[model samples]
Target: MSMLVFFFVPAVIFLTVVAPIWLILHYWTRSRQNKGLSDEERQTLEDALSVAERLEKRVATLETILDAEHPNWRTAREDDYRRGGS
Candidate 1:
């Protein structure tokens, strides 16, 4: 029984205290070592940026077309706003 106590107490302390602390520190350091955007996240961000650029170009083209078709379009809009015409 004395022999059992000698080994069992330390084993219990190691399992209940030291093991959890070691595991927490191991994972904490591992996560800190690999802190950057993953490949999939980077790809998604790039795709979104490209789509935004395309949409911006489309809007500029449509605005140019509208300006060519209606030279006084902006003044007409202001007059309509003053008269409360929708």
Candidate 2:
């Protein structure tokens, strides 16, 4: 029983003290490592932004062309919607 107490006390102390700190530190560093965007992720974000900008400009250009070609296109589209026309 004395030998068991000797080993058990240290094991209990380690579990109560060291184990939690170790777990917290392990997860903290892992989270910190993943906190920032990687270079490839940054490049992908830039590419997505560029494509979005181009698509936005294309939409504006298309709207302008539609305005010139059919001045009442917006109203016509709304009317079509109201009438449930596909």
Candidate 3:
């Protein structure tokens, strides 16, 4: 009975306390490791956003030019594109 109690007490304590603490720390560290983008990844994202903004500005300028030169240009081009007349 004493031998059984000794083994069982430690086994229960390990399972109930040590296991949960170990699991929590393991997952916590993993989450910290995965939390942020690397410098290269952040730079790539910034480059993509910059390019997108520039393209948007260019498109807006082109649309303004087209509006000045041909008022119904969008309607006409949209119709042609919809009809597969690119």
RMSD values, in order shown:
3.6, 1.0, 3.1
Question: lDDT of all predictions, in order shown?
Answer: 0.96, 0.99, 0.98
Q: Tens digit of lDDT per residue, candidate 3, span 1-86?
A: 99999999999999999999999999999999989999999999999999999999999999999999999998999999999999
For model 2, state the Cα shift of residue 21 in Å.
1.1
Tens digit of per-residue lDDT, candidate 2, span 1-86 = 99999999999999999999999999999999999999999999999999999999999999999999999999999999999996
Clashes of each: 0, 0, 0
Q: Name every residue pair that clashes in candidate 3.
A: none
Write the residue-wise lDDT of candidate 1 on 8-84 in tens digits: 99999999999999999999999997898889999999999999999999999988998999988889999999999
Q: What is the lDDT of residue 60 in candidate 3?
A: 99
TM-score result, candidate 2 = 0.93
- The TM-score leader among the candidates is 2
- Residue pairs with clashing backbones, model 1: none
Candidate topping lDDT: 2
